[model samples]
Target: MRALLLSLLLGAAVLPALAAAPTDPPTPPVPSTTDGLIAQPWYRPHHLIGQVAGGQGMVTVGVGYTTLRGRLDVDVLTGYVPRKYSITPMGIFTGKATYSPWTLGLGASRWQVRPLSVGGLVNYTASRGMNASLDGKYPKGYYWWPARSRAGAFVGGRVAYELPTKANGQPRTASLYYELGTNDLYLVSLYSNIKALSVADILTLGIGVKVDL
Candidate 1:
């Protein structure tokens, strides 16, 4: 009887010790490829953009992606020009890419400044009333470029104000920028009439805003 009782007590003690003993913590789960892409989806745009008169259209609005530590912005925009400005009301679609080499933050202020920004854009305008530059009436090589498509380059600066952080802990910002640009056609005209055409004559002014999403 005593032996049976002692054996039961020993068994209880040993079972508790074994239960309390810690095993190697489960190996942390290896992050899968799907987990890595959750931070930024391919279809998500980083910000929204709107602009006026960069030779794109009278008013342009679009979505954009901010990459390269905010130094690069790629935007796709659509714009409209009133009939008063052209033979007919026109719709313009533009793809633009801008790069700013440096960004300076103001001393303890939310304001920031980008001293230099350079970019290029390609745009297509659709209008029924506009005559085609390279039509059957003209020889194949007579007109070197299409009337509806334009390519341009610009240089500018930007001023931005930091906004409150979002619920997801993402920072937000709003920026205003300006671009002075010239289109390929304008550049060609300047090249042909260097004495008559001034740099200011060919330049187009554009102002825009960007808001983080």
Candidate 2:
């Protein structure tokens, strides 16, 4: 009877410890937020594009980044233009940054719209006889801005048609964007000759597409 009582006591003592022991090890928490939507490295580019006009080129290929949940963007593009469009046949490079204050999502659809965007850009044109600054051929301060490089401001819109993703991964996405803008030289000309120039005459239009990576 003593041995039987001792066994019963031991069983009772172990019961609480067994109940407290975890059957499975603890797991690291899965993030419940939209962190997955961000790129692995913050500085990595998020998109690529092809564009026309905006003083970069008649046609250009570019890369871009999106931030603030797609509220802001920046892009760099490069391309070629014929002598007919410039003083000489040239290669052009451009950098642009923009902010869209609002994005309106279409109901239950994969469409997202950024109805307004404002931005600025700088463009460099490489020509055989051309440099950003004027050559000795021109007197000092004859021209207000540089000859081979131009800076401009723009306003625009973008409409994105998000593609459906398969069960395995991230959502596919693409967008169409267009902008109208003016350069420093154009503005100088406009204000200097207001009677001869209209806003339409000073503005340049750019149409492009962006593909998310």
Runs off by more than 4 Å, candidate 2: 1-37, 131-133, 137-142, 165-172
Q: Whose lDDT is greatest here?
A: 1
Q: What are the lDDT figures for the candidates, one per model?
A: 0.89, 0.82
**Per-prediction TM-score to the true structure, in the order listed:** 0.80, 0.76
Residue-level lDDT of model 2, residues 106-152, one tens digit each, is 99889989899999999888888565556677788876667888899
* Model 2 worst lDDT run, 10 consecutive residues: 30-39
Q: Report how far off residue 5 is in candidate 2 (Å).
A: 44
For residues 3-100, could you state the per-residue lDDT of candidate 1 as single tens digits? 99999999998988788677646676543321222246878987898999989889989999877767888999999999999999999999999999
> Which ranges of candidate 1 are over 4 A from the true structure?
1-38
Error of 1 at 100 (Å): 0.6
